[model samples]
Target: MKDVYITRISKFLPNAPVGNDEMESILGQINGKPSRAKRVVLRNNGIKERYYAINSQGEITHTNAELTKEAITKLFDDSFTQNNMELLCCGTSSPDQLLPSHAVMVHGLLANKNLEVNSASGICCAGMSSLKFGFLSVKSENSNNAVCTGSERSSTRMMASMFNEEAESLSSLEDQPIIAFKKEFLRWMLSDGAGAMLLENKKNETGLSLKIDWMEAYSFAYELETCMYSGGEKQEDGSIKPWTEYSSKQWLEDSIFSVKQDVKILEEHVISKGVESLEMVFEKYSKDPSDIDYFLPHISSNYFAEKLKTGIKEKGLKIPESSWFTNLSSVGNVGSASIYLMLEELVHSGRLKKGDKILLSVPESGRFSYAYAHLTVC
Candidate 1:
């Protein structure tokens, strides 16, 4: 059993910004009162605030495929090109369209780099899945220089009139409490953003930085159809339209079962490779949870964060303030790019040193959990 290492990482976000109080205020106004909006405002999204790209009208700005291109360009220039890279991959949900797919477009944007570029799109977990593929690419002799970027233009997906109309209508009636709760939750929780990263096979001078270990990715085909977005229908305006509805309650329910199964699979496989228990995985691979120094969590809300915390406790792990990056409190959910954003902070801050192991975890999306080892502090 060999391990794959991550050489470099990077992230990108839209220019707009939003916070919890602002969200609360908006919902309060829409719902007609602060008291009325309380339940919707107090979920466990781990995000106290988040950013959104907006236009001159101050409405949420849509994710521009061009912006994603710019972010990836920046990442390559600033993060990994110097490693003498050979491959590129982009993880995203906001594609140029349903046909060519985002990856192929991004690959072309890089001027047909001749390196294999995968623009992968599969909801939230596409980011992690892309990385897993990149690692396997490196380990299996498919490619050595790999860069992965995960970005989303969720703002583009907002169904404003539909949302507001539904919100207002639901506010007026109490017919189906469950349905009402689900709709409201999705409206308030989903957000718009993007993030990117650069990876390479070459070890730097000191050789003490982040390294990838092992990645096991699985998707339950049975649950595939359970979550999806229908193709846009042709409109009288001669344009296609996407379904704006998001099933949050369905998503949450499906996620719990998916994550449990995925994690169980990863635990069983990795443990057999000598990475037993939460403690052994940390200690043998790098450091103990107690001495981990910091925890950069991929949390979307408080409810999600508490769920992760419970998972940590169940595994007998301890978390410290330094070990956690709570940006979700401000960034809503950046989807695929969440962990990379946190990793970028750790590196830029110079807090991470060569030889210090940073344990990274992703509990959602693909209903998967993976821990990677960043081996050095450079």
Candidate 2:
């Protein structure tokens, strides 16, 4: 067994930025209004702009495979086309289809591009899971070199008319119960992007950018109880039902094929239970929040910033607000890619000094899971 070092990271964003006001033209009028729900969602989440895998016409432009390919391409050296990677791990909130995994699809595209990688590709739970998978594989000597990717095309595949759509005969969007509850909240929180990182067992001669120190993860699924989820449906026999079986109209009405979250539950769970789990991680690593030089967290809402700060203080750790860095306010919540995007922003800022220790926390509401890790610049 050997330790892992993340040597290189690359990322990609689709098309241009989509501003808050511009969404009305793409999503059309909702509840007989020009996407007032979008405006409200922005107010709640504090998202300025997000990238979509679509043009102004709202047509599908890039698939999950393409989004990931862009980042993966930047990771490898052009002259070194033959893959040195022994494993390919992909984490995606929205895969192009339900059949083949997104990792395998990306593998196929790599072959077409004359970039041959013969490693097995496997899909894991999105968010920190894919990155951790790479770390473990290299640590266990399963692969000397591995590439991990996280991508999200959540916006492009969303069910049509996802928000308030006021028919001349129907009720206004505000008056619609389900729209006011589910659709409005999630519509603005997500963006499309992809991030990839290359991990190796051996450190470079110049030394790696970040040497993996410690990694840990935990789940509070029982306490959260479906705080956030997206997928098809469940039948009476507890069997899974295909999302396509339902009409697009039913998708919105039933809250199917969408991210449904209870905000109060999610927030409470994160602040209370989430922090408790995080503290255990700190104890496991024998490090305090003050020992960390940089703190990067992937949070969907800016509102949680203070809550997390308060929680850290209560745990007897004294991390400063100025030490925090993230791209969420600008890039929006990029699902599984958020953690990688935040790390990318930090490394590119040129503020990091030698021996600086950084801590990253990525919490995915998919099942109330959290992963925290410590890394140091060499």
Candidate 3:
């Protein structure tokens, strides 16, 4: 197997910041009670605070295409850009356009516009998926550097209709109508942020101890058509609306089902590679789960983490409390970019060491419940 190491990584949070308390306050102001907002604030999502982009008046901010450009440019400035960037991929949910992809916009913003750039638009899973693709591209070619950026401006879609949808699904009322004449609309949790990672075939001796040794992804029960996306809107007075309408609960169900199937496929593939279960796989590699300095679990929330923990324990794997890192308390779920952000945070804090194995688990889309586990240490 060839080695693909991450040389540099960068993340961006816009000027606007929102914390759990702040969210509670915002929800209270709109919904008439702080407790009513608790469902989205303190429960399913393990996030307490998030950042957003703001305009001149100082209202709660939304996503911006320009910010994405700014963040990408900054990432390139920090990372080594000696030659033309052969590949540029943007993984984002809050895109400026649905058809053209955010990748082209990001690529156009580059100091080296002459470089080839593209967007890997998928759901939240697109971030790591793009990274996987970018890593493969770098490994197979002479191209020394390629960039992957995940940026989102979530506020664009946040509306009362969406909140009503979330309120209904997360409501305590079990008897709530499954079928409503007027479907409750929901504004997705819109957090404004961006993350960029520069991958190359080089290694830094003094950087974080984390590295990528092996990575494999399995896609099963993949269905693009079954997936529903809001295409556009129906305006009231014959005018056009900006956002589309989709079922969040349905999205969750589909992703969960797909993830379960995909995990089975992953376990089979890993076992066929001569490693079985979490313990056997670690042991075969001559490393103990206990030896792992940090465990970066995907930030799906306490519910999701609890499920993953149950699975890990059932497999007889041991990871120390100190080894586990989570940012859910600070940043809600950044989707595909969450685990990567956790890894970057660990490295930037001067905690990463040489030969220290860091695990990367990425859950693709809402449907592909898959994780990419790699043991890479400097």
**Candidate with the greatest lDDT versus the true structure:** 2
- Clashing residue pairs, backbone N/CA/C < 3 A, model 2: 31-164
The 0-to-1 C-alpha lDDT of every candidate, in the order given, reads 0.53, 0.73, 0.55
- 1-378 in candidate 2: lDDT tens per residue? 797888888899998898987765665555445444566668867888888888887788889889988888888776334266677778887888876767888888776433323222221136467777788878988778778888888785443465433232245444543344454577767889998888888766664478888788887766546556566554445344666788877665665666666676676676776678778888787786777889988788887877888888888777767788888878888888888888877877788887898988877665577778789988
Segments in model 3 whose C-alpha atoms lie over 4 Å from true places: 24-37, 55-64, 77-79, 82-84, 161-190, 205-210, 220-291, 373-375
Model 2 residue 315 lDDT score: 80
lDDT of 1 at 219: 43
lDDT (C-alpha) at residue 368 in model 1: 31
lDDT-based ranking, best first?
2, 3, 1
- What TM-score should be assigned to candidate 2? 0.87
lDDT of model 2 at residue 104? 80
lDDT of 3 by residue, 291-373 (tens): 77777766455645665665666666777767778876676666545665676677688766677777665554333435456
* Alpha-carbon deviation at 68 in model 3, angstroms: 3.4
**By summed lDDT, which 10 consecutive residues of candidate 2 come out lowest?**
115-124
Query: In model 1, which runs have C-alpha deviations exceeding 4 angstroms?
Result: 1-7, 21-39, 42-46, 59-64, 78-85, 162-179, 206-208, 218-291, 318-322, 365-378
Total backbone collisions for each predicted model: 37, 1, 15
